[model samples]
Target: MGDTHKDLIFLIPLPGGRVARVPIDVLEHYVDPSARISHGGEAEEEDVTAHSMSVDPRTGASIWHTDWELGQCDYTDENGFPQSAYAWHRHPLGNEYTEIYQK
Candidate 1:
């Protein structure tokens, strides 16, 4: 798929931690979908975004979005439980996961 006109939508975090994302198009910050990105690699600070949109099932309209981080990890210790493995998912929709991570 080409540009969904939905790429690189971002929320610039404020110093006070009050989250606010502009609903306008800032052409300079758009990340081209076709551009190649290294798999499991760290994206630059500017490329990181923190917003998720949920469309209304019935209306097909974007009814909600939020600026919060959700971390997902998969690692097991010798005991077979969850190990404290950590990493960042720095893709376009990256959450900047709360735990430590490598690119």
Candidate 2:
């Protein structure tokens, strides 16, 4: 029979020798679905790798290190100027999840 688990869990290592048991759904909500480690507008699928994981002490949120960076948003400002957008990192328990974070 196929797997029947309701959700998959990921064991993420954190700073200070702590580990987080995060669910797949939480990961999907915090991580950008389209994010990829790219350069010159070309997606380097094979070379994509996470450098490290840590907690933002100020916010108590988990952070994932990667070469991928977020750029301007597709929509423009009131004067038709591009606006900046931020990349997503793993923050399973962070209370900042919004529609933008959804897959």
Candidate 3:
């Protein structure tokens, strides 16, 4: 019964030079509009992509960690199409999370 439209896509690029795109939201109701929703106009939901990497687990060394944020308000390319940004996560922590933007 909501007036908004939302779509989500999960992408995984394999080392074999192949990309897999999966629609996780359709598989499970992890997110619900009826649940605690945001009200602010600029408070639009966004989809996040995370990449994790580490040299050694025990030492937690030879490197550090990092992450990136791409909001719904971002641009794709020459076209005005809205595209998600590439998120880089150094450690395999958190939900590997992403946001669902209201369109």
Best by TM-score: 2
Q: Which candidate is the best by lDDT?
A: 2
Backbone clashes for every candidate come to 1, 0, 2
Question: After TM-score superposition, what is the CA distance of residue 43 in candidate 2 from its true location, in Å?
Answer: 9.1
Instruction: Output the better candidate (1/3) by TM-score.
Output: 1
State TM-scores per candidate.
0.23, 0.32, 0.22
Per-residue lDDT tens digits of candidate 3, residues 1-103? Answer: 3433445666854433467876765646665443221121232233122222222335533322223322222224446455554432122243333333222
Per-residue lDDT of candidate 1, residues 2-41 (tens digit)? 4566554557544343667754367455755533332222
Off by over 4 Å in 2: 37-45, 48-103
Flag clash pairs in model 2. none
Q: Which residue pairs clash in candidate 3?
A: 46-99, 48-98
- The true-versus-predicted C-alpha distance at residue 42 of model 2, in Å, is 16
| Ranking of models by lDDT | 2, 1, 3
Cα lDDT over the full model 1: 0.38
Across 1-103, the per-residue lDDT of candidate 2 in tens digits comes to 2354546787865444467998777787678554433222444333333222333435644454333233222324468565444433332333322112223
Candidate 2's TM-score: 0.32
What's the TM for model 3? 0.22
| Sequence-dependent TM-score of model 1 | 0.23
